[model samples]
Target: MDGIIVVNKPKGMTSHDVVNVLRHKLKQKKIGHTGTLDPEASGVLLILAGKACKALQFLKDTDKTYQTSIEFGYITDSDDIFGNKIEVKEINYDFDFEKVLQSFIGPQKQKVPMASAKKINGKKLMEYQREGISNIDVYNEIEIYSISVLSKENYSFEVHCSSGTYIRSICRDFGYKTNNLCCMKELVRTKVGRFTLDMAQNLDEIEIDTVKLYPLSYLLDHIERIDYEPVLDIYNGKHVRIQTNANQVCIYDKEKPIAIYQRDHFDVFKSIRGLW
Candidate 1:
């Protein structure tokens, strides 16, 4: 109950809905999700349970990956298929698939989705937009790590992109090249940092008894491991000096992680998180 559960979130349910369901199913409070996935997207939702909730702040900058489809020949205010069609035009010219992919290269400023959870003037941007307000400006810098145009069928193409980048906005920008309509038809988050879709659990297929939970040590793989007798004394709210070449170490009580320590300026190991 104190570990992370990577759920393959289904489309149409808000991220909050997933937290609510898990809270009920797991019968534990203090639950939270790593990032917000739009209701239209599905896959790789990292849910923290119990004491694991404290680790959510550490995952905010984790990179994300998604496989998405873009439909050309129409544009919408919300950038996705759920929004009202704002423009439509026939696809008559030859589609330069390579050029379209290259347009998204490097860093770019993308307007946050209107229906996003981003706040503007202390209110959610979507809330203000609902009341016919448009003066608020909200944009974020996102890098397109890589893009591959899988296929082109008539006026649609499948694409993959890095996290913090919006597929719908990319589609809208792609449409601008030919003044055609474009929107995201489908989306699936395939990866989140080290976690992949292969390890995700589907809602209907979730089994509490068979649930696989990764220990905190799995996430701290980059940190060094320390095994010392006096380390336990320091880890137990007492300070002790032990000579070790490792600058950082994961103190383990047998197989379970008890605490993570980093060398201080005075060459003392300090606890990052104490396990209790």
Candidate 2:
């Protein structure tokens, strides 16, 4: 009951709604999600059950990938089709989508949608919008690793980006760059770090008490593994120094991971998270 559960989220249910359902069925009080998916969007939603909630800090920085459809012709206040229609336009001419997609492949400052949960002065931006607030200036620096069209007929495309990147906002920006109004018609988060859609299971398919819990080492796919000699020190919350080729690695004792360590100083390995 204390590990990660990958849920293939269904559209129309907010991420919190899924968590509440699992919490009731699993009978575990402590349940949390790695990130959230909009009510209109669906895909991989990782639920941390019981003690696994502590793993959020470790996984929060992981990158994400999404397969989304950008519907051109009209724009909404929320940047998605669910919001109040603010503008409407017709496609007068063909536009270059590939070139515009490539231009977003680096660091850029993106404005937060008023429909988003991002807070301003301890209040959600959406809350401000509800209070008749307009044009609240807020921005987040995000990095887009890559983006490409998956199918033009379906207006489907894929994007790999940093943790907090908003696909809805990207759809809004794409239309602005192309001189046409656009909004996200659908969104599906296909991947979160090593967790992909293929590895996800539907919510109805899980039995909280009987579901197999993935080991903490599952998140260490990107780090190198090293066999270290200090088993007692690490278990006793002690730092162990070891020379490793990688800047960060999973330290193991007898093939069991003790902790994820990073080279903090000159040859000094510090424990980032305890796996055991």
> Highest TM-score among the candidates is held by which one?
2
Candidate 1: tens digits of C-alpha lDDT, residues 168-243: 7777777777666678888888888888899999976766675667676555556666666865584575554547
lDDT by residue (tens digit), candidate 2, 1-276: 667888899998999999999888888898888888999888998888765675566564378999998888898889999999988998734777777888889999998888989988899999998989968988899999999999877778999999778899899988888888988999999998888898888878877555656765565555788887757777776677878667887777775566778888878888878865
- Candidate 1's TM-score reads 0.85
Candidate 1 regions off by >4 Å? 154-162, 234-250, 262-264
Give candidate 2's whole-model lDDT: 0.82
| lDDT winner | 2
Candidate 2: 10-residue stretch with minimal lDDT: 52-61
- The alpha-carbon lDDT assigned to residue 179 of candidate 1 equals 64
Screening candidate 2 with a backbone cut-off below 3 angstroms (N, C-alpha, C), the clashing residue pairs are none
Please give the clash total of every predicted structure, in order.
3, 0
lDDT of each: 0.73, 0.82
